[model samples]
Target: MKKLILPFLCIFLLVSCKNETKQGDSNSNELGTAVKDTVIVEVPKVPIEKTIKEIKEALTAKGFKTFEYVDETTKDTILMQQYFMAFLKRSAIKMQNEEESERLQKLHMEHLSKMHELGYADISGPFGDDGDISGVTIYNVPTLKMADSLAKSDPMVQAGRLEIEIHPWWAAKGIGLR
Candidate 1:
């Protein structure tokens, strides 16, 4: 009985030792590579102001509404512009290369004409709806009245083909006009 007990203890110790070694090897294999922590930094934003005193004066002279100004600022104008240019380039490519989609180019040209007629110098990118692409235009016009009038009376706006949003320079910056 003593001899049998001694043999059983030795077998148990050997099996446990083998399992411990296997576990250690597995853990070391998992630790082969060192992990790195990444840090991201964000920069402060700067505001851009556009004064449309001339555009506003022109609108007022045309007997449009009284001028009220709303300032406009966007966090990522460059990104927005890039997106706009990409859309334009893609649309142009599609129009030139694809025969079945001429209407898109036509609608875009019409919208561009409407924007140009209003003396809008800045385009806020294109918004698409039901296969139609419409763009927002920003004018450095002088008065809110003129902006409102142009927004309301423009052919695109009247036909519900375009949307117009007016913001005074101060309003864009959340500041009050003096």
Candidate 2:
């Protein structure tokens, strides 16, 4: 008889414990809204192509022309924290002669092309509208000193026919060959 009573009490205890857990799970808030164990949140994802298109749209709206090139390895987008920007502007000093100016122009083009080929210059172009600023060049160099050296190496800049203003620029990386 004692053995039977002990087993029954154990069973009763187990049943009572399960019922308490169920009751606790069903408890509601003050407003009578049942609580949920887990909440599902929906998040929207943007494709890389869509993001790039939107960026191009914003740039075009502000009179910026963008160029793109493909990378052979790693298809992931290259986002960079900072870069160097060189602003090419006409200096106050005049060239010695038209021939000298032409010679300097050729040398300048060669220098720019070499930089572009060596993976230093990512983008460079003249301003479409006439302004004090002649053109702009973006470099992937790591330091200001390197960028300054590059600018100073230009024949036009060295000859004082053109002046360069270097500034730290923020840009997205891996857009082009650089």
Candidate 3:
């Protein structure tokens, strides 16, 4: 009975150890080679000139006044914020009369409401003298189509109070959300 028990226990231990070793080996192999090889295909790059021309034409067709700047690689995010803030401050300063201030306030409220309806959070402008006058409000709408529609419909955007600069992803590096 003792001999039988010893042999059975040895067999069980041997089987368990073999199973554990097999599991470890199989796991390593799966980790190493589980990724299936995919065919690599290279896509031809679109000519920058052609792409820019197309975008310009589309913008023009959509009734947006387009300006083409040379590829100076200016820091856009910072520059955009500064430009927006300056514009807003100048506009606010021009509003000296109570009527003008009321108009501007109404416009601001309308702009904010429109942006909210379009499902976007407003991005505030860069630093400046007064928080209200110097800060510009920015929103990223659901789609380019929606943005274009909003631009056409919104008085602020149409009057150039809210300037929308469309950028390709490649050009938008290092620009943190406001």
Candidate 4:
């Protein structure tokens, strides 16, 4: 029994190492020189200064602004034109009954249309019923207070059917339809 176990273990070890040895041998010629079949290309290194200059040039060419990294703690990195916007996060639980919900929806549409006409709203849409938040409305306002004021004017918010959380947001200046 001991002899049979030893032979089986030896056979397993030989089988496992057979493939690796064959692969290693194929990578070299009979003379032990790395064959032309296996090509090894080394990447050329560019100086740090030259690489940085090239990156900056590429960004400039593509109309992108570049800036140096500052210390941590704040996310203020690149200096792009900052625009104030508002995000209206609809509450997950509906406070209104069916009738109230329908009425407020109408009011909401009217209010959004008014915002669109005034060039204050960039985008607005519902987030589907499955999500924690009901919908999102992005407003192109000048200040957080202004965004809150505009949000408060919604009939749903006034009736306590929808909750509004006002936040100050900054984004790239020229985006979305004019």
Mind giving the per-residue lDDT tens digits that candidate 4 earns over 1-178?
9989999999999998775566666666665556666667987696434444565566466544444443367764433322334445556557678987898889989998898889777777777576545666776665566667887898877776677765555544433575
Listing every candidate in turn, what is its Cα RMSD in Å to the true structure after a full C-alpha superposition? 16.3, 16.3, 11.4, 15.2
Query: Estimated TM-score per prediction?
Result: 0.28, 0.53, 0.30, 0.48
Top-scoring candidate (TM-score):
2
Residue-pair clashes, model 4: 0
Where in model 1 is the C-alpha error above 4 Å? 1-108, 114-119, 128-134, 170-178
Residue 172 in model 1: shift from native, Å?
Answer: 12
Give the number of the best model, judged by lDDT. Answer: 2
lDDT of each: 0.47, 0.77, 0.47, 0.65
Candidate 3 lDDT over residue span 42-126, tens digit each: 8769643445556556646754444544435863322111111112333322424677556755776676576667544244444
List residue ranges in candidate 2 displaced over 4 A. 1-78, 176-178
Question: What C-alpha lDDT, on a 0 to 100 scale, does residue 76 get in candidate 2?
Answer: 52
Better of 3 and 4 by TM-score: 4
Query: Candidate 1's residue-wise lDDT over 36-93, tens digit each?
Result: 4645797658655444555445545854344343335644222111101112111223
- After superposing candidate 3 on the true structure, give the runs of residues whose Cα lies further than 4 Å from its correct spot: 1-97, 122-127, 130-134, 151-153, 157-178
lDDT for each residue of candidate 2 in 90-144, tens digit (9 for 90 to 100)? 8888947988888888999999999999977888888998788999998767678
- Which 10 consecutive positions of candidate 1 have the poorest summed lDDT? 79-88
